[model samples]
Target chain A: MTITLNNRIETFSPQEMSITQIMDEKSFHFKMLIVKLNGTLIPRESWPLTVVRDGDRLDIIHLVSGG
Target chain B: MTIIQNITSHLSVKKAGIAGAGGLGSNVAAALVRSGVGHLVIADYDIVTKPNLNRQFFFADQEGQSKVDALRENLLHINPKADVEAHFCKITALNAGSLFGSCDVVIEAFDCADEKKWFAEWMIAHYPAKPLIMGSGIAGYGSPETLRVQRSGNLYICGDQRETNEKLVPLLAPRVIMVAMMQADLALELLLQEKPL
Candidate 1:
């Protein structure tokens, strides 16, 4: 399956994967993250259950410190 | 109309709400007031510290003073006629909409990604009609060429879009102020859209 992560296309072995698997694969270990699937916000608690299919656009934004 | 009159007429009546009165917030607020923004609502719970003098709009004498108080005073000095409301408290999702509800525009100048995301989500959910200006990835003494403006619906974000933490690259005066000024300019542009003929 192919998916768009942060505007870049990537190929995945599985046809579909949970949001948690995607985050784990990408190593997005940041605590302060904003995850959106197809422009819809996916709450942190739902990441394990949320599924990402082919052609999905995932936006994982991290927050940094410094005013 | 004279240049002064034109500027005053266009901006003197617009209200701006700024979240986070640190480097970005304080600088943005000062620029808006100097540009003739009529009213400003600024919030921040922090007090001025020794390190803040490096880039913030503060003086040595302001050390230990509340950020909002010092910022309000400085803004008033720039435009004595401007109305400034200082909230010496941390802004959260619960109080953000109420605090800046009536302002023409809300500028998100938070330092933490969590806070920024919370406020951004809150604004989108509650005040969808209002425009929000935000900054991210503004760190180090990098080139100004990296900075750019991006738009998504009513959300206008200005920065390099590269998340550089303070550990890797320290936040200097030049880069921080550059993004702050970009945010201020974008706020002004949005305010001017509501100007009366």
Candidate 2:
């Protein structure tokens, strides 16, 4: 199967490539994911249900610890 | 302009919530309350230590008080009619939603970029309808006029951006107050629907 990461759709294994899957892959230990797919920000509660598709324009804005 | 008049006319109306109650947070709360924003829900789990006196606008009498309590007292002094709800706890994923749920907008006043990111991400994710306003990059004690506002749709970050490597004043007073005032202005504009530039 193939799915897009960011704006460039790339081929990937059959593993799910949705927001939840990407966070899991990124090993995002944070409690939330700030993702905007096609200009629509996916709610934190909805990230688990949001299914990433082919050519999905995604912007994953995460938190960092910098003063 | 007329926005100020409108605020006074609608004195019964509550504007929004503020996440931090430290340097920037306390100023924002004071401005809003003075402008008759009606209601404020301020959260901060820190206390006012001697080290905070240089930048934080605390009187000599408030030295040993909790940050939330001190700030609330200052705000009430500005507008005795204002309703203030103070929470003496650090804002985190667990309480951000419940604490910020009722307000139309939320301010991320923490200067630490990491804490801003955490609060911004949580607010955008959990409460997409509510706008998140924050400050950043005001390091190195720069000019007060350098402050500006940038917006990406509903998210707005207002502050001065300085190089990360620069060594700034150990405790810059002017720049901190400048950025804090700019943030308060932006917050009021958002609340009042004033003509924004």
For model 2, the superposed segments whose C-alpha errors exceed 4 Å read A1-67, B1-3, B163-169, B194-197
Off by over 4 Å in 1: A1-62
TM-score of 2: 0.72
- Candidate 1 — what's its lDDT? 0.86
Candidate that would win on TM-score: 1
Clashes of each: 1, 2
Fnat per model, in the order shown: 0.47, 0.19
Please, what is the TM-score per model?
0.82, 0.72
